[model samples]
Target chain A: MSHTTLQKKKLIARVSRLKGQMEAVERALEAERPCGEILQLLASVRGALTGLTGEVLDDHLREHVLNAEDDAARAEAVEEISEVLRTYIR
Target chain B: MSHTTLQKKKLIARVSRLKGQMEAVERALEAERPCGEILQLLASVRGALTGLTGEVLDDHLREHVLNAEDDAARAEAVEEISEVLRTYIR
Candidate 1:
Protein backbone atom coordinates (compact mmCIF):
# COMPACT_ATOMS: atom_id res chain seq x y z
CA MET A 1 0.00 0.00 0.00
CA SER A 2 1.08 3.58 -0.55
CA HIS A 3 1.87 5.84 2.31
CA THR A 4 -0.84 8.07 3.69
CA THR A 5 -1.02 11.52 2.12
CA LEU A 6 0.67 12.95 5.17
CA GLN A 7 3.48 10.50 4.83
CA LYS A 8 3.94 11.38 1.20
CA LYS A 9 4.19 15.03 2.09
CA LYS A 10 6.78 14.29 4.71
CA LEU A 11 8.76 12.23 2.26
CA ILE A 12 8.64 14.97 -0.34
CA ALA A 13 9.87 17.42 2.24
CA ARG A 14 12.77 15.15 3.00
CA VAL A 15 13.54 14.98 -0.68
CA SER A 16 13.43 18.73 -0.91
CA ARG A 17 15.92 18.97 1.88
CA LEU A 18 18.14 16.59 -0.02
CA LYS A 19 17.90 18.84 -3.04
CA GLY A 20 18.99 21.73 -0.89
CA GLN A 21 21.91 19.72 0.32
CA MET A 22 22.93 19.01 -3.25
CA GLU A 23 22.85 22.69 -3.99
CA ALA A 24 25.03 23.33 -1.00
CA VAL A 25 27.59 20.93 -2.37
CA GLU A 26 27.49 22.74 -5.64
CA ARG A 27 27.95 26.11 -3.98
CA ALA A 28 30.85 24.89 -1.96
CA LEU A 29 32.47 23.67 -5.12
CA GLU A 30 31.92 27.05 -6.81
CA ALA A 31 33.43 28.79 -3.83
CA GLU A 32 36.45 26.50 -3.91
CA ARG A 33 36.06 25.58 -0.29
CA PRO A 34 38.71 23.45 1.40
CA CYS A 35 38.53 19.75 0.61
CA GLY A 36 38.24 18.76 4.25
CA GLU A 37 35.36 21.16 4.80
CA ILE A 38 33.58 20.01 1.70
CA LEU A 39 33.94 16.43 2.79
CA GLN A 40 32.36 17.22 6.12
CA LEU A 41 29.35 18.85 4.50
CA LEU A 42 28.94 16.09 1.96
CA ALA A 43 29.06 13.52 4.70
CA SER A 44 26.33 15.36 6.57
CA VAL A 45 24.13 15.43 3.51
CA ARG A 46 24.69 11.76 2.82
CA GLY A 47 23.73 10.85 6.36
CA ALA A 48 20.45 12.71 6.05
CA LEU A 49 19.69 11.03 2.77
CA THR A 50 20.41 7.60 4.21
CA GLY A 51 18.25 8.28 7.20
CA LEU A 52 15.43 9.21 4.87
CA THR A 53 15.97 6.10 2.82
CA GLY A 54 15.92 3.91 5.91
CA GLU A 55 12.66 5.41 7.12
CA VAL A 56 10.97 4.84 3.78
CA LEU A 57 12.36 1.35 3.54
CA ASP A 58 11.14 0.46 7.02
CA ASP A 59 7.69 1.72 6.18
CA HIS A 60 7.54 -0.47 3.11
CA LEU A 61 8.63 -3.52 5.09
CA ARG A 62 6.08 -3.04 7.85
CA GLU A 63 3.22 -2.17 5.57
CA HIS A 64 3.74 -4.75 2.85
CA VAL A 65 5.94 -7.62 4.02
CA LEU A 66 5.09 -7.75 7.71
CA ASN A 67 1.34 -7.87 7.16
CA ALA A 68 1.52 -11.42 5.89
CA GLU A 69 -0.75 -13.58 8.04
CA ASP A 70 1.39 -16.65 8.62
CA ASP A 71 4.32 -17.19 10.95
CA ALA A 72 6.51 -18.49 8.16
CA ALA A 73 5.81 -15.48 6.07
CA ARG A 74 6.71 -13.09 8.86
CA ALA A 75 9.91 -14.92 9.64
CA GLU A 76 10.91 -14.89 6.02
CA ALA A 77 10.12 -11.24 5.69
CA VAL A 78 12.20 -10.44 8.73
CA GLU A 79 15.19 -12.34 7.42
CA GLU A 80 15.11 -10.70 4.02
CA ILE A 81 14.62 -7.28 5.54
CA SER A 82 17.49 -7.74 7.95
CA GLU A 83 19.82 -8.93 5.26
CA VAL A 84 18.91 -6.19 2.80
CA LEU A 85 18.92 -3.42 5.36
CA ARG A 86 22.25 -4.53 6.72
CA THR A 87 23.75 -4.68 3.28
CA TYR A 88 22.07 -1.66 1.72
CA ILE A 89 22.35 0.98 4.42
CA ARG A 90 26.09 0.77 4.74
CA MET B 1 24.21 15.72 -13.58
CA SER B 2 21.01 14.20 -14.80
CA HIS B 3 21.29 10.97 -16.68
CA THR B 4 20.68 10.81 -20.36
CA THR B 5 17.27 9.54 -21.42
CA LEU B 6 18.76 6.14 -22.06
CA GLN B 7 20.08 5.91 -18.55
CA LYS B 8 16.75 6.97 -17.14
CA LYS B 9 15.02 4.28 -19.14
CA LYS B 10 17.48 1.69 -17.92
CA LEU B 11 16.92 2.73 -14.34
CA ILE B 12 13.19 2.50 -14.87
CA ALA B 13 13.58 -0.97 -16.21
CA ARG B 14 15.45 -1.95 -13.09
CA VAL B 15 12.68 -0.43 -11.02
CA SER B 16 10.13 -2.38 -12.99
CA ARG B 17 12.00 -5.55 -12.18
CA LEU B 18 11.98 -4.60 -8.56
CA LYS B 19 8.24 -4.14 -8.82
CA GLY B 20 7.93 -7.63 -10.20
CA GLN B 21 9.99 -9.03 -7.38
CA MET B 22 7.72 -7.31 -4.87
CA GLU B 23 4.68 -8.80 -6.52
CA ALA B 24 6.26 -12.19 -6.49
CA VAL B 25 6.81 -11.88 -2.78
CA GLU B 26 3.19 -10.89 -2.34
CA ARG B 27 1.95 -13.85 -4.34
CA ALA B 28 4.05 -16.26 -2.35
CA LEU B 29 2.60 -14.88 0.85
CA GLU B 30 -0.91 -15.13 -0.53
CA ALA B 31 -0.29 -18.71 -1.60
CA GLU B 32 0.77 -19.63 1.93
CA ARG B 33 4.18 -20.81 0.89
CA PRO B 34 6.39 -22.35 3.58
CA CYS B 35 8.18 -19.77 5.71
CA GLY B 36 11.57 -21.02 4.70
CA GLU B 37 10.62 -20.80 1.06
CA ILE B 38 9.17 -17.33 1.44
CA LEU B 39 12.29 -16.20 3.29
CA GLN B 40 14.39 -17.26 0.38
CA LEU B 41 12.26 -15.30 -2.03
CA LEU B 42 12.18 -12.21 0.13
CA ALA B 43 15.90 -12.41 0.64
CA SER B 44 16.32 -12.53 -3.10
CA VAL B 45 14.13 -9.49 -3.52
CA ARG B 46 16.12 -7.61 -0.89
CA GLY B 47 19.36 -8.52 -2.58
CA ALA B 48 18.14 -7.18 -5.87
CA LEU B 49 16.94 -4.03 -4.23
CA THR B 50 20.27 -3.52 -2.54
CA GLY B 51 22.09 -4.09 -5.79
CA LEU B 52 19.99 -1.43 -7.45
CA THR B 53 20.64 0.99 -4.62
CA GLY B 54 24.34 0.42 -4.86
CA GLU B 55 24.37 1.02 -8.57
CA VAL B 56 22.57 4.33 -8.28
CA LEU B 57 24.74 5.42 -5.38
CA ASP B 58 27.90 4.66 -7.29
CA ASP B 59 26.71 6.59 -10.26
CA HIS B 60 26.03 9.66 -8.18
CA LEU B 61 29.48 9.48 -6.63
CA ARG B 62 31.17 9.28 -9.98
CA GLU B 63 29.07 11.77 -11.88
CA HIS B 64 28.61 14.43 -9.27
CA VAL B 65 30.89 14.25 -6.24
CA LEU B 66 34.07 12.81 -7.71
CA ASN B 67 34.43 15.34 -10.47
CA ALA B 68 35.57 18.13 -8.20
CA GLU B 69 38.30 20.23 -9.78
CA ASP B 70 40.91 19.75 -7.07
CA ASP B 71 42.71 16.91 -5.33
CA ALA B 72 41.56 18.03 -1.87
CA ALA B 73 37.94 18.02 -3.01
CA ARG B 74 38.39 14.54 -4.37
CA ALA B 75 39.90 13.27 -1.17
CA GLU B 76 37.08 14.71 0.93
CA ALA B 77 34.45 13.32 -1.36
CA VAL B 78 36.10 9.92 -1.23
CA GLU B 79 36.14 9.89 2.55
CA GLU B 80 32.47 10.85 2.81
CA ILE B 81 31.45 8.32 0.21
CA SER B 82 33.45 5.52 1.79
CA GLU B 83 32.00 6.24 5.19
CA VAL B 84 28.45 6.51 3.92
CA LEU B 85 28.70 3.42 1.76
CA ARG B 86 30.14 1.37 4.59
CA THR B 87 27.50 2.61 6.99
CA TYR B 88 24.57 2.36 4.62
CA ILE B 89 25.12 -1.06 3.04
CA ARG B 90 25.18 -4.27 5.01
Candidate 2:
Protein backbone atom coordinates (compact mmCIF):
# COMPACT_ATOMS: atom_id res chain seq x y z
CA MET A 1 0.00 0.00 0.00
CA SER A 2 2.97 2.26 0.38
CA HIS A 3 4.82 3.40 -2.74
CA THR A 4 3.10 6.74 -2.49
CA THR A 5 -0.11 5.01 -1.70
CA LEU A 6 0.30 2.86 -4.74
CA GLN A 7 0.87 5.92 -6.82
CA LYS A 8 -2.33 7.46 -5.59
CA LYS A 9 -4.30 4.43 -6.54
CA LYS A 10 -2.79 4.38 -9.97
CA LEU A 11 -3.51 8.05 -10.46
CA ILE A 12 -7.11 7.61 -9.51
CA ALA A 13 -7.59 4.67 -11.79
CA ARG A 14 -5.98 6.43 -14.70
CA VAL A 15 -8.03 9.55 -14.19
CA SER A 16 -11.17 7.49 -14.07
CA ARG A 17 -10.35 5.93 -17.38
CA LEU A 18 -9.51 9.30 -18.72
CA LYS A 19 -13.01 10.38 -17.88
CA GLY A 20 -14.31 7.50 -19.87
CA GLN A 21 -12.16 8.43 -22.79
CA MET A 22 -13.49 11.95 -22.69
CA GLU A 23 -16.98 10.63 -22.84
CA ALA A 24 -16.13 8.43 -25.75
CA VAL A 25 -14.68 11.35 -27.60
CA GLU A 26 -17.87 13.23 -27.14
CA ARG A 27 -19.85 10.35 -28.47
CA ALA A 28 -17.77 10.35 -31.63
CA LEU A 29 -18.52 13.97 -32.28
CA GLU A 30 -22.24 13.52 -31.80
CA ALA A 31 -22.33 10.48 -34.06
CA GLU A 32 -21.20 12.26 -37.17
CA ARG A 33 -17.89 10.43 -37.17
CA PRO A 34 -15.61 9.87 -40.17
CA CYS A 35 -12.51 12.07 -40.15
CA GLY A 36 -10.26 9.03 -40.12
CA GLU A 37 -12.27 7.63 -37.25
CA ILE A 38 -11.91 10.79 -35.26
CA LEU A 39 -8.16 10.88 -35.75
CA GLN A 40 -7.80 7.41 -34.31
CA LEU A 41 -9.69 8.41 -31.21
CA LEU A 42 -7.51 11.42 -30.90
CA ALA A 43 -4.43 9.26 -31.04
CA SER A 44 -5.73 7.12 -28.26
CA VAL A 45 -6.36 10.07 -26.04
CA ARG A 46 -2.94 11.45 -26.78
CA GLY A 47 -1.36 8.17 -25.88
CA ALA A 48 -3.31 8.02 -22.70
CA LEU A 49 -2.41 11.47 -21.57
CA THR A 50 1.20 10.81 -22.47
CA GLY A 51 1.18 7.79 -20.21
CA LEU A 52 -0.23 9.86 -17.40
CA THR A 53 2.41 12.50 -17.77
CA GLY A 54 5.13 9.89 -17.78
CA GLU A 55 3.89 8.37 -14.57
CA VAL A 56 3.95 11.62 -12.70
CA LEU A 57 7.34 12.47 -14.13
CA ASP A 58 8.68 9.06 -13.20
CA ASP A 59 7.55 9.42 -9.63
CA HIS A 60 9.05 12.83 -9.39
CA LEU A 61 12.39 11.59 -10.65
CA ARG A 62 12.49 8.63 -8.30
CA GLU A 63 11.27 10.09 -5.04
CA HIS A 64 12.24 13.74 -5.09
CA VAL A 65 15.13 13.97 -7.53
CA LEU A 66 17.07 10.76 -6.99
CA ASN A 67 17.26 11.16 -3.23
CA ALA A 68 19.02 14.49 -3.06
CA GLU A 69 21.50 15.49 -0.36
CA ASP A 70 23.19 18.85 -1.12
CA ASP A 71 25.70 21.06 -3.07
CA ALA A 72 23.79 24.27 -2.94
CA ALA A 73 20.61 22.22 -2.78
CA ARG A 74 21.72 20.40 -5.89
CA ALA A 75 22.44 23.64 -7.69
CA GLU A 76 19.13 25.05 -6.59
CA ALA A 77 17.51 21.90 -7.79
CA VAL A 78 19.13 22.18 -11.18
CA GLU A 79 18.14 25.82 -11.46
CA GLU A 80 14.59 24.92 -10.62
CA ILE A 81 14.79 22.22 -13.21
CA SER A 82 16.06 24.63 -15.81
CA GLU A 83 13.09 26.89 -15.22
CA VAL A 84 10.73 24.01 -15.71
CA LEU A 85 12.47 22.93 -18.88
CA ARG A 86 12.31 26.43 -20.25
CA THR A 87 8.61 26.64 -19.62
CA TYR A 88 7.85 23.24 -21.03
CA ILE A 89 10.00 23.45 -24.14
CA ARG A 90 8.36 26.62 -25.33
CA MET B 1 8.66 25.41 -39.39
CA SER B 2 5.93 22.86 -39.21
CA HIS B 3 4.40 22.38 -35.78
CA THR B 4 5.74 18.86 -35.53
CA THR B 5 9.21 19.98 -36.47
CA LEU B 6 9.09 22.70 -33.90
CA GLN B 7 7.93 20.30 -31.28
CA LYS B 8 10.82 18.00 -32.13
CA LYS B 9 13.27 20.82 -31.76
CA LYS B 10 11.89 21.85 -28.43
CA LEU B 11 11.94 18.29 -27.16
CA ILE B 12 15.54 17.85 -28.22
CA ALA B 13 16.64 21.03 -26.57
CA ARG B 14 14.85 20.21 -23.36
CA VAL B 15 16.28 16.70 -23.28
CA SER B 16 19.78 18.00 -23.81
CA ARG B 17 19.44 20.41 -20.91
CA LEU B 18 17.99 17.68 -18.78
CA LYS B 19 21.12 15.70 -19.53
CA GLY B 20 23.20 18.56 -18.22
CA GLN B 21 21.17 18.65 -15.04
CA MET B 22 21.71 14.94 -14.61
CA GLU B 23 25.43 15.49 -14.79
CA ALA B 24 25.18 18.31 -12.29
CA VAL B 25 23.20 16.11 -9.92
CA GLU B 26 25.88 13.46 -10.19
CA ARG B 27 28.54 15.99 -9.39
CA ALA B 28 26.58 17.20 -6.41
CA LEU B 29 26.41 13.66 -5.07
CA GLU B 30 30.09 13.12 -5.71
CA ALA B 31 30.89 16.28 -3.76
CA GLU B 32 28.94 14.86 -0.82
CA ARG B 33 26.59 17.78 -0.64
CA PRO B 34 23.44 17.73 1.49
CA CYS B 35 20.32 15.68 0.93
CA GLY B 36 17.87 18.57 0.79
CA GLU B 37 19.71 20.44 -1.92
CA ILE B 38 19.95 17.40 -4.15
CA LEU B 39 16.28 16.67 -3.75
CA GLN B 40 15.37 20.16 -4.84
CA LEU B 41 17.31 19.81 -8.06
CA LEU B 42 15.62 16.50 -8.74
CA ALA B 43 12.22 18.02 -8.13
CA SER B 44 12.92 20.81 -10.53
CA VAL B 45 14.00 18.35 -13.16
CA ARG B 46 10.86 16.34 -12.70
CA GLY B 47 8.73 19.43 -13.03
CA ALA B 48 10.44 20.40 -16.22
CA LEU B 49 10.01 16.96 -17.72
CA THR B 50 6.39 16.88 -16.70
CA GLY B 51 5.77 20.20 -18.34
CA LEU B 52 7.40 19.01 -21.51
CA THR B 53 5.34 15.85 -21.51
CA GLY B 54 2.18 17.83 -21.01
CA GLU B 55 2.98 20.07 -23.90
CA VAL B 56 3.46 17.16 -26.21
CA LEU B 57 0.33 15.50 -25.00
CA ASP B 58 -1.68 18.66 -25.41
CA ASP B 59 -0.47 19.18 -28.92
CA HIS B 60 -1.26 15.60 -29.84
CA LEU B 61 -4.72 15.86 -28.37
CA ARG B 62 -5.46 19.08 -30.17
CA GLU B 63 -4.08 18.15 -33.57
CA HIS B 64 -4.83 14.45 -33.75
CA VAL B 65 -7.48 13.44 -31.25
CA LEU B 66 -9.77 16.41 -31.00
CA ASN B 67 -9.90 16.85 -34.74
CA ALA B 68 -10.94 13.31 -35.61
CA GLU B 69 -14.07 12.55 -37.61
CA ASP B 70 -15.31 8.96 -37.47
CA ASP B 71 -17.09 6.91 -34.74
CA ALA B 72 -15.45 3.49 -34.63
CA ALA B 73 -12.05 4.99 -35.24
CA ARG B 74 -12.61 7.31 -32.35
CA ALA B 75 -13.76 4.44 -30.15
CA GLU B 76 -10.72 2.40 -31.07
CA ALA B 77 -8.53 5.37 -30.38
CA VAL B 78 -10.04 5.85 -26.96
CA GLU B 79 -9.60 2.17 -26.14
CA GLU B 80 -5.96 2.34 -27.15
CA ILE B 81 -5.58 5.39 -25.00
CA SER B 82 -7.15 3.63 -22.07
CA GLU B 83 -4.66 0.83 -22.42
CA VAL B 84 -1.78 3.25 -22.37
CA LEU B 85 -3.13 5.04 -19.36
CA ARG B 86 -3.56 1.76 -17.52
CA THR B 87 0.01 0.79 -18.20
CA TYR B 88 1.41 4.09 -17.04
CA ILE B 89 -0.72 4.43 -13.95
CA ARG B 90 0.07 0.88 -12.97
Candidate 3:
Protein backbone atom coordinates (compact mmCIF):
# COMPACT_ATOMS: atom_id res chain seq x y z
CA MET A 1 0.00 0.00 0.00
CA SER A 2 0.98 3.60 -0.46
CA HIS A 3 2.31 5.50 2.50
CA THR A 4 -0.85 7.51 2.77
CA THR A 5 -2.96 4.41 2.75
CA LEU A 6 -0.75 2.82 5.34
CA GLN A 7 -0.99 5.91 7.50
CA LYS A 8 -4.74 5.97 7.25
CA LYS A 9 -4.95 2.34 8.25
CA LYS A 10 -2.68 2.85 11.18
CA LEU A 11 -4.64 5.85 12.34
CA ILE A 12 -7.96 4.10 11.98
CA ALA A 13 -6.71 1.06 13.84
CA ARG A 14 -5.27 3.13 16.63
CA VAL A 15 -8.40 5.20 17.02
CA SER A 16 -10.69 2.18 17.04
CA ARG A 17 -8.53 0.61 19.71
CA LEU A 18 -8.64 3.77 21.75
CA LYS A 19 -12.41 3.86 21.46
CA GLY A 20 -12.60 0.38 22.91
CA GLN A 21 -10.28 1.31 25.73
CA MET A 22 -12.42 4.30 26.52
CA GLU A 23 -15.54 2.14 26.54
CA ALA A 24 -13.82 -0.14 28.96
CA VAL A 25 -13.14 2.80 31.22
CA GLU A 26 -16.81 3.71 31.17
CA ARG A 27 -17.75 0.14 31.99
CA ALA A 28 -15.26 0.11 34.82
CA LEU A 29 -16.85 3.21 36.27
CA GLU A 30 -20.28 1.61 36.04
CA ALA A 31 -18.95 -1.54 37.70
CA GLU A 32 -17.34 0.42 40.52
CA ARG A 33 -13.83 -0.67 39.72
CA PRO A 34 -11.02 0.64 41.93
CA CYS A 35 -10.34 4.30 41.53
CA GLY A 36 -6.64 3.59 41.08
CA GLU A 37 -7.21 1.27 38.13
CA ILE A 38 -9.58 3.72 36.52
CA LEU A 39 -7.06 6.48 36.93
CA GLN A 40 -4.35 4.33 35.42
CA LEU A 41 -6.58 3.53 32.47
CA LEU A 42 -7.29 7.20 32.02
CA ALA A 43 -3.61 7.97 31.95
CA SER A 44 -2.92 5.21 29.46
CA VAL A 45 -5.72 6.41 27.22
CA ARG A 46 -4.34 9.92 27.34
CA GLY A 47 -0.96 8.65 26.28
CA ALA A 48 -2.48 6.71 23.43
CA LEU A 49 -4.42 9.72 22.28
CA THR A 50 -1.24 11.70 22.32
CA GLY A 51 0.55 9.12 20.25
CA LEU A 52 -2.16 9.02 17.60
CA THR A 53 -2.25 12.78 17.40
CA GLY A 54 1.49 12.89 17.01
CA GLU A 55 1.47 10.55 14.05
CA VAL A 56 -1.22 12.47 12.17
CA LEU A 57 0.37 15.81 12.93
CA ASP A 58 3.72 14.54 11.76
CA ASP A 59 2.24 13.61 8.42
CA HIS A 60 0.50 16.96 8.08
CA LEU A 61 3.64 18.92 8.74
CA ARG A 62 5.69 16.86 6.37
CA GLU A 63 3.19 16.83 3.50
CA HIS A 64 1.60 20.23 3.94
CA VAL A 65 3.55 22.59 6.18
CA LEU A 66 6.94 21.79 4.77
CA ASN A 67 6.04 21.04 1.20
CA ALA A 68 3.36 23.60 0.49
CA GLU A 69 3.93 25.69 -2.58
CA ASP A 70 3.73 29.15 -1.07
CA ASP A 71 4.22 31.12 2.10
CA ALA A 72 0.49 31.73 2.39
CA ALA A 73 -0.19 28.03 2.62
CA ARG A 74 2.51 27.62 5.23
CA ALA A 75 1.15 30.49 7.27
CA GLU A 76 -2.35 29.12 6.95
CA ALA A 77 -1.13 25.75 8.16
CA VAL A 78 0.55 27.35 11.13
CA GLU A 79 -2.56 29.30 11.99
CA GLU A 80 -4.69 26.20 11.69
CA ILE A 81 -2.34 24.46 14.05
CA SER A 82 -2.36 27.44 16.39
CA GLU A 83 -6.12 27.18 16.65
CA VAL A 84 -5.68 23.61 17.78
CA LEU A 85 -3.06 24.70 20.31
CA ARG A 86 -5.33 27.39 21.65
CA THR A 87 -8.04 24.87 22.34
CA TYR A 88 -5.79 22.91 24.67
CA ILE A 89 -4.38 25.99 26.35
CA ARG A 90 -7.72 27.63 27.09
CA MET B 1 17.31 31.28 16.78
CA SER B 2 18.25 28.05 15.10
CA HIS B 3 15.43 25.78 14.05
CA THR B 4 16.21 23.44 16.90
CA THR B 5 16.13 26.29 19.39
CA LEU B 6 12.88 27.54 17.96
CA GLN B 7 11.38 24.09 18.16
CA LYS B 8 12.39 23.69 21.79
CA LYS B 9 10.91 27.05 22.65
CA LYS B 10 7.67 26.29 20.88
CA LEU B 11 7.35 22.91 22.58
CA ILE B 12 8.05 24.37 26.00
CA ALA B 13 5.62 27.19 25.52
CA ARG B 14 2.90 24.92 24.25
CA VAL B 15 3.33 22.39 27.05
CA SER B 16 3.42 25.07 29.75
CA ARG B 17 0.24 26.58 28.37
CA LEU B 18 -1.41 23.18 28.37
CA LYS B 19 -0.41 22.69 31.97
CA GLY B 20 -2.07 25.96 32.92
CA GLN B 21 -5.22 25.01 31.04
CA MET B 22 -5.38 21.74 32.93
CA GLU B 23 -5.07 23.58 36.20
CA ALA B 24 -7.94 25.80 35.12
CA VAL B 25 -10.06 22.73 34.52
CA GLU B 26 -9.28 21.52 38.01
CA ARG B 27 -10.17 24.90 39.44
CA ALA B 28 -13.41 24.92 37.50
CA LEU B 29 -14.38 21.67 39.12
CA GLU B 30 -13.67 23.11 42.56
CA ALA B 31 -15.68 26.20 41.68
CA GLU B 32 -18.62 24.07 40.60
CA ARG B 33 -18.78 25.34 37.06
CA PRO B 34 -21.63 23.95 34.93
CA CYS B 35 -21.05 20.49 33.61
CA GLY B 36 -21.48 21.73 30.06
CA GLU B 37 -18.66 24.23 30.46
CA ILE B 38 -16.43 21.65 32.05
CA LEU B 39 -17.10 19.29 29.19
CA GLN B 40 -16.27 22.02 26.73
CA LEU B 41 -13.01 22.67 28.47
CA LEU B 42 -12.18 19.00 28.46
CA ALA B 43 -12.80 18.76 24.73
CA SER B 44 -10.73 21.86 24.07
CA VAL B 45 -7.90 20.54 26.15
CA ARG B 46 -7.95 17.29 24.24
CA GLY B 47 -7.63 19.19 20.97
CA ALA B 48 -4.72 21.20 22.24
CA LEU B 49 -2.98 18.08 23.48
CA THR B 50 -3.45 16.57 20.04
CA GLY B 51 -1.92 19.60 18.36
CA LEU B 52 1.06 19.64 20.67
CA THR B 53 1.64 15.94 20.16
CA GLY B 54 1.44 16.38 16.42
CA GLU B 55 4.06 19.10 16.39
CA VAL B 56 6.51 17.11 18.46
CA LEU B 57 5.93 13.91 16.53
CA ASP B 58 6.37 15.71 13.22
CA ASP B 59 9.68 17.08 14.35
CA HIS B 60 10.78 13.70 15.59
CA LEU B 61 9.92 12.01 12.32
CA ARG B 62 11.72 14.67 10.31
CA GLU B 63 14.80 14.96 12.46
CA HIS B 64 15.19 11.40 13.65
CA VAL B 65 13.02 8.83 11.85
CA LEU B 66 13.60 10.08 8.35
CA ASN B 67 17.17 11.03 8.97
CA ALA B 68 18.25 7.98 10.91
CA GLU B 69 21.53 6.37 9.87
CA ASP B 70 20.58 2.81 9.03
CA ASP B 71 17.94 0.13 8.75
CA ALA B 72 18.35 -1.03 12.32
CA ALA B 73 17.76 2.46 13.62
CA ARG B 74 14.69 2.82 11.44
CA ALA B 75 13.31 -0.48 12.64
CA GLU B 76 13.97 0.55 16.20
CA ALA B 77 12.11 3.80 15.62
CA VAL B 78 9.08 1.97 14.29
CA GLU B 79 9.11 -0.36 17.26
CA GLU B 80 9.38 2.59 19.61
CA ILE B 81 6.34 4.13 17.99
CA SER B 82 4.50 0.80 18.13
CA GLU B 83 5.06 0.68 21.86
CA VAL B 84 3.43 4.06 22.15
CA LEU B 85 0.51 2.88 20.06
CA ARG B 86 0.12 -0.20 22.23
CA THR B 87 -0.20 1.95 25.31
CA TYR B 88 -3.09 3.81 23.73
CA ILE B 89 -4.78 0.70 22.36
CA ARG B 90 -4.59 -1.28 25.56
Best by TM-score: 3
The top-ranked prediction according to DockQ is: 1
- Per-residue lDDT tens digits for candidate 1, residues B1-90, read 332122555654564565565455455545555433444554555566556556655655775466665787567667756765665555
User: Could you tell me the fnat of model 1?
Assistant: 0.05
Runs off by more than 4 Å, candidate 2 = A1-90, B1-6, B68-80, B87-90
- Model 2 lDDT at residue B40: 53
Question: Could you give the interface RMSD of each candidate, to one decimal?
Answer: 10.5, 12.8, 16.0
CAPRI quality band, candidate 3: incorrect
TM-score ranking from best candidate downward:
3, 1, 2
**lDDT: the better of candidates 1 and 3:** 1
User: Model 3: how far is B31 from its true place, Å?
Assistant: 40
Q: Report how closely model 2 matches the true complex, as a DockQ value.
A: 0.05
* Position A11, candidate 3: lDDT: 46
Q: Which numbered prediction scores highest in lDDT against the true structure?
A: 1
| Fnat for each model | 0.05, 0.00, 0.00
Per-residue lDDT for A31-60 in model 1, tens only?
555433444555555566556556655765
User: Candidate 1 DockQ score?
Assistant: 0.07
| Rank ordering of all candidates by lDDT, starting from the highest | 1, 3, 2
lDDT of 2 by residue, A5-82 (tens): 445445545645654654554455455453334335545645665565455545544544555455654465456455
- By DockQ: ranked, best first: 1, 2, 3
